[model samples]
Target: MVQGHYESLNRKNDERMNAIPYCDTGEVFEADTIANVWKREDKEWLKRTQSDRSGYEYPRLGESPYINMTDDFRMEKKVICQDIFWSCDGTSFVSVHNDFGIRQYLVPEESNTDKLNRNLLLPFTRFFRNQSIVSCAIDPFYTLYNENSDRLAGDRIVVGGKNFPLQLYSLMDGQCILSYDTMNKINGEYETVYSVKIDVESRVYTGSCRNKVAIYDKSRRDAVWMNQSTKKASKGRQSIISCFEEQPMGGQALSRGSLLCGSYANEMFQVDCRHQRLERLNYTRTVAGGIVQILTSDNGRYVYVVRRNSDAISIYDRRNLQHELNVLRLPFRIHHNSAKLKAYIDTAYGLSMGTPQGTILNWGRDLVEFGGVPSHNSVDDPLITSIPPESEWRTNLSSTIPATVVKNCPGDPELFALSHGGTISLCRFGG
Candidate 1:
């Protein structure tokens, strides 16, 4: 009976593997040339075919002026933004800065390009903290309204940073709403939580120093579960975790929800929440540099990994974690610090990433509708490459891209990107 069950499992696995088509890596070109050519071609194609198609116009790629200095700052040094996130309603956004300042700005409904270009994006609310915020997350359920126009759970954000535990802050009044003790004592010191993520279930996951992951609910201050394994790696002890993301549940019948994490060693792993143990994925092996970010699809079907000092972003199938789905290579180098990526897979299927060269690179995935379904490539061509940014822009404010946070506004065909140097770029899909 056991042998029969094993055979059936193997058959199912084979069928699943055969269903996915291999992505083809066609002829490659220089980054700048690719972007220029794609823009030209896209314009030509739209001009020819858009007249026939009604209702869905492609987004216009445009930019707002550099939102750096305010009228009060003429001689002071610029404050570097560490991270930024858009609210669920897309009406406002919050930015975390290296100077321990958090600022919130409301998006104006009208496009006042001339007025905005002449001035900075002034914040409506500002909060100050003693420690620099490393990462933050908004409440998933915190939206502006309900079906009857009633206010829901809104105006709350959780932040984790240097020497402090995860604290929930109110966006309305800029007050400390709650705090979660995600830190733990290791040896003689307390570990600082570096990454924080909130899920639909109201649970927060925090990744801290010494490769630790802790789970906490808003109702309690103590961590519900903490995982700290001391397994020796090929190069001594493991490094701290850099990021955390919720992953999809696999096909296993006994599987529980999983939390994906990346470490400073460029290694990826999943924590089975129910089992409370670490599970290795196919890409668990270490790479050259640390992981910059791990972006997963909304439905959790795909994961895109960005690594430090690497020119390529790897795409993976959530179901088949053993093999990569495709590789999107960029022309510019991703520096060891201050790089970010935002990927979308639905109707607007594409990705945008920031480079150390002060440029934001974007690529439109060749899907069935956008660019007819791709044909399978030969085994010799393993890479299913993405064309260079449909839109590429370099900032004039700073030499290095300190922090690149890209947020896609819901219900709109636009993108908002922020740099640590206090510049903001607005890109519309077509226009």
Candidate 2:
């Protein structure tokens, strides 16, 4: 499987490199013209990418789809970054490190040169905590338009780690504005928060060790609801809450959305948030190795499940969770760390995820000719096929260190790759 995937990837890479003529453009990538190539270059791209209704080919993997070691953002002291999140407004991004540090990088809207220099771009604000941080999230209400229209736009974040009580910090002044002390305790010790997520209504959801999940409302002093797997750890069993995700609103009129929690067990739990007292609605079918991360498509049409240490990701029908649509196989095995997967289904059917080997792999469906017969499927149909899928590999991060997370700028063509060795690599799509 690995050899076949590599052969397909190499063939596609060669085709892409040979299709476009090498040229040098001296234009800087400003905020206004993001995710676009030069006018002449775009015409050539359209000529090469023109397909039938099925737009499965990837746009571009950058100038070259390999690691460039000369441009990495390194700090004076080595501190591994556990996770990173881009703000609602594409102006900045935040990173949580193992050294109990939270750093924010302010992306300048305007740059002087065509190429961006990682050295000049540094973290403008710094926040520190006593314990290590495992997961972090930005306030969903923090937006430039919202802040200007309403004075109370959220500028705070909820962060939790290998400690007690999830805390919310003020991004403006670097202060602990609020803390949720409603976390459940087991065996006289609080469970470590493995993952965190906040919904549109600002309700915080956290997954912890021992297959535990807690939901907190800002108005209440305690958790509104909490749950744990029926299978106990006392029987020499070890199953942790690997990840949690919230369903999208999808034009619904509800104040809160349903939540999905994944554990090391075969089944996953779903909680309906419509009732005052949330309860487990149902459990999905048995998944091998359990699910490490759950990703919802932008349109809420499908759900992507990433399994622990599995190279392939399973896709399911959003409305009918029990139905399996297709599987995405990767070129390499995902280590035990369980890298996060980012979905870009808005403009294209593509997914990006990092590997412990420091390579960022992307899977984009390809438009096949179907033996000279043109074929297409409606937008409502699930993206699946019997044949093995194709993938593109780009190792922008360190080859030695494991890659923790790969995030795309909110409205730009740039990508930020975070490595386990406290280094970040910035790669632009057209650069």
Candidate 3:
């Protein structure tokens, strides 16, 4: 199954090369104007600029111009990035650093010369002292223009921090729009919010912490429902709900109060936020490992659960939670400290995972045929396929840089993977 997979040789070739050929244009042009026409060297240029403006040059054809290079974006930081999220349009992405600073980068519309020059293009960055952003969610309903007045109202980003208030910021300027105190004394004092999800249409947000989950309604400017427990037994069994995801049904414009969450108690459950009390649709306890993350299919039919520090993932059918459809195991151990488990299931790529070993593994849907059968020898099971030497879809990053997040770019064949060391790689499959 791994045959025909290709690994990008751009990085390897970049290290052994020194200089690229270029046509030195004697005239100078503005940086923006030069960047606009840098790709077309064959076109006639009518210079209307002074020599001191900025000397410009264009790469000749067949010279392996840097503009044709595939290595899109890369950045280095003093600390490992905590999390990275792509915008709804896939044109930009935001990454959070351990030092409570947030950096947003624009996905270059055109390829660039080098990583340093690419980053020096002035990305949007903001820092918050004494506040470490734990989770962030982009408002799905936000648009550039107001519906009523046709005026511009910028998009908003919701962010949660450790022991800090849940704050909303303008996506354009990083200015605070609103803030809510999420710390609750009833569930467990000093409990920090670890997860947050926003229902943009409803203008409501859900936050999960140590032993409680709170739903804040933007219209009311207060929590509509806050679940907190005071019982001793509840506290003992209570586990932090580290992950929360809204599973919007098919044909629904917005999520209809249905949410899926994973807890440290080794359980995966669904919650309905319409009611005042905690109402569950389905709950199941899986393997001994804690539930690290929960992901749903585009149709909301299948649920994939990632286990912390475990090599296996449990897949369940949403209609029937009595038993898991299948339990698929990986070849290597996953990083326990990794906050997010990147998984995507689509027709083109059945199911792909970015592992801690810096490899993207594709476990196609063919394994589902082995369901309901117990294998006598786990190692020799036909369902378990190892990474082969050559596959058209597999990519092996450096062993030192573990891929913390992997996401597919919309309307394109590209897959973006962010490493633990703050490096982002763009890979094209089946091209």
- Show pairs that collide, candidate 3: 2-390, 2-391, 4-391, 4-392, 5-391, 5-392
Q: State TM-scores per candidate.
A: 0.69, 0.69, 0.66
Relative to the true structure, candidate 3 reaches a TM of 0.66
Preferred candidate (TM-score higher): 2 or 3: 2
Clash counts for the predictions, in order:
9, 0, 6
**The 10-residue segment with the lowest total lDDT in model 2:** 17-26
Q: 353-398, model 3: which lDDT tens digit per residue? A: 6656666655443332223122233645444232221122334345
**lDDT top scorer:** 1
**CA deviation > 4 Å runs, candidate 3:** 1-77, 112-122, 142-154, 183-191, 200-203, 228-238, 246-257, 280-287, 338-341, 345-350, 364-396, 413-417
lDDT of 2 at 239: 64
Per-residue lDDT, model 3, residue 365, is 35
Model 2 TM-score, all chains together: 0.69
Candidate 3 lDDT score relative to the true structure: 0.49
Candidate 2 per-residue lDDT over residues 335-417, each given as its tens digit: 55544433332124245566557655555422221210113444564444432334444543346766566666555534443
Misplaced by over 4 Å in model 1 are: 1-77, 112-120, 144-152, 183-188, 236-238, 246-256, 283-287, 338-349, 365-403, 425-431
Tens-digit lDDT track of model 1 for 305-400: 777667767777777767767666677666554334433332243455555555455544432122211333344643444433444544333445
